[model samples]
Target: MSAPTAQRSVLPPRPSYAAVLRVPHARRAFTAALTARLSYGTVSLALLLSVTRATGSYAVSGTVLSLFGAASVLLMPVRASLIDRHGPRRALPPMATLYGALLCLLAALTWRPGAPAALLATAAALAGAFTPPMGPTMRALWSELVHDRALLQRAYSLDGVAEELLYVSGPALIGVLAGLAPPACGLLLSALLIVAGACAFVTSPVMPGPRPAQAPHKRSVRPSGIPGLLAPVAVAGGVGLALSGLDLLVMAFTAQHAYDTALVPWILGALSAGSAVGGLLNGALPWRMPARTRLCCFAAALGLVIATTALAPDLWTLTAAMTLAGAFIAPALTTAYLLADELAPTDARTRAGAWVNAAVNAGSSTGALLTGLLIGAVPLGICFLLSGGVAVGTALVAGPRRRRYADRS
Candidate 1:
């Protein structure tokens, strides 16, 4: 056999998730990030219930949540830019502190019934504005920690799976706490978790210091700032839009079939479980395909699989179909983050990740709103098709083009 053939035949053993944790200080930093991120999972439910109880109005509660989510998602890039400029050690702690204090204040105000609605809304929005960009920051840190591309892929996968689990379990924990005590109690716990986790994360020895300030005249500017990030951001947004709509579509399907609404969680759980499995498998394998190509393929596959969910005949079949669709979710997201990391300038890594993060959140919010409107007006199957089409179309648009622009002579 030739040297290349022989080398290909004797590839090294695939690196395990254990290899990721073995990176020095990775465990502590990752653990801290997860702890802080759990607050995100719990805060929505806790805040919703607390606001509802305090205001005694669903409309008010909904408005408050919208304000909070908008502030958090829309301002993510701004907060991340500060971290990139000032360093996480300096930027993150203050954000966490202020966020925690706002949560505390909101909890206190909601603890007593009849707090002013305007006051509550203002406080929640402020809290969201200060919410630390933990997920993006952690991904940026992962790039710093793992030198090998394959190893970094595994780290992102592990991080994705853990974050998914945190979200799944966070609301369950809040549900239990809500059963025992007031919803504000859960909100208070959220505050504590973020404050403690942010402190721990910043103090980790592996975390890097701040980037040097750029001179005003030396700073580079692109006309459409995020041109390099277009593909990843588009794909990420498409995935988010599809996934968010899935929940509502499933609900409508179950309701039409006269199936118990209680079964909704189990079906959704299958999607999450499938995503977790796919993520683990994606990271474990060593593939020859380039990351960019892999991203396009993963996204296209997800869109196609999700489109098939429109034809499911029953809840069980729908659950299975959704699980299959979900298999591509994490791998697509992992590849997007990888691409973002590669395309971003070193000094603005956090901001780059944040843009991807923001795309997902913005798409999700828009999806939920649009899907809700479409549910009563259009046929459910058609809605599913539209949802999946969003992903497929984005994948097509974001895929690499053959044409290259001529350089200015």
Candidate 2:
């Protein structure tokens, strides 16, 4: 008789989001992580409003925020490197405590009238520079805990959604709190929640600590991980360029048409709403191809759709093109998150995430510079066209690495 043929079991390309939650202590960890990160979305707006209220100059507030933001972006990867070298538990708590304390101090200083804006700005920079690297650490933790590829994808998707919601609601909450309490109170609340949440997350039952004895993945041909690992960082930079340009394009569009500034949010909301829907759908549904190939496909679609922005003659039409373009954003990001997890050196995964984050920040700065030069010189539509071209460039960036990531090994 012929030997029995062997059959390998096939897993779905995507799994239920509930499966991610059902894992031991997954809910607790995810919840704590989410709350800790809410500060990411809330703190900036709260600080901006509070500082502006106290100082009475948008220039001072902008300077303070810019300094804090620049410092935070530059320092985050350093903290993430520490987290990876040690572990979240050892690296997160102490820093979280100190950062949170600094945040409280900044808030207190901002609460009083006649505070020196420059000194407060310097203090804010120091506080934010040391802000605990919670977001990337939680992502690394999720990657470790959710061993199943399918579940990990969903988890990242959920993270993207949570990020969008927090960003939208954070600004609105600051507005509401201004009516009910001191505006700076919202900043203090964000600080406290981050402290509590970071502590709880580390203490969660499923969260892992450093395992020095455990070996890491096979080294890459160069100093980086897989050949494609670094590509996502570049792609992230491109995406950021597109995002900042889009924001500026909206501002110009509003100004050109005499549309109320309040109406700009609706257009912006259309973009974010598209991304949120895409993230939810992507998490729930499996892709037909590998994440890498599918991501390139999404990038292509985003580029092409954004190109249509140049053709849009009205606000509603431009909003439609923007929405279509935004649909690809979260999916590309989710793919990048997963790819970075798969390909990063086990000891540097957190750093990889932080590097990607930094690239995005740097790209935003670059985009603002470009937009400043382009906004008055050409049609706003042409500026979007340039950003779309950047999106297409991301696809080109990923294309060379496609074979490396098709790997289901």
lDDT of 2: 0.79
The predictions' CA RMSDs to the true structure, in order, are: 3.0, 4.9
Candidate 1: clashing pairs of residues: none
Q: Give per-residue CA lDDT, model 1, range 310-341, as digits (tens).
A: 89899889989888887899999999998888
Q: What residue pairs are clashing in model 2?
A: none
Q: 273-388 in candidate 2: lDDT tens per residue?
A: 99999988888786658766776677777877877787777778878877887788888777777777776766777877777777677777778879889999987778878888
Model 1: how far is 106 from its true place, Å?
0.5
lDDT of 2 at 374: 97
Candidate 2 has a TM-score of 0.89
Off by over 4 Å in 2: 1-14, 211-227, 401-409
TM-score of each predicted structure versus truth: 0.94, 0.89
Please give the CA lDDT of all the candidate structures. 0.90, 0.79
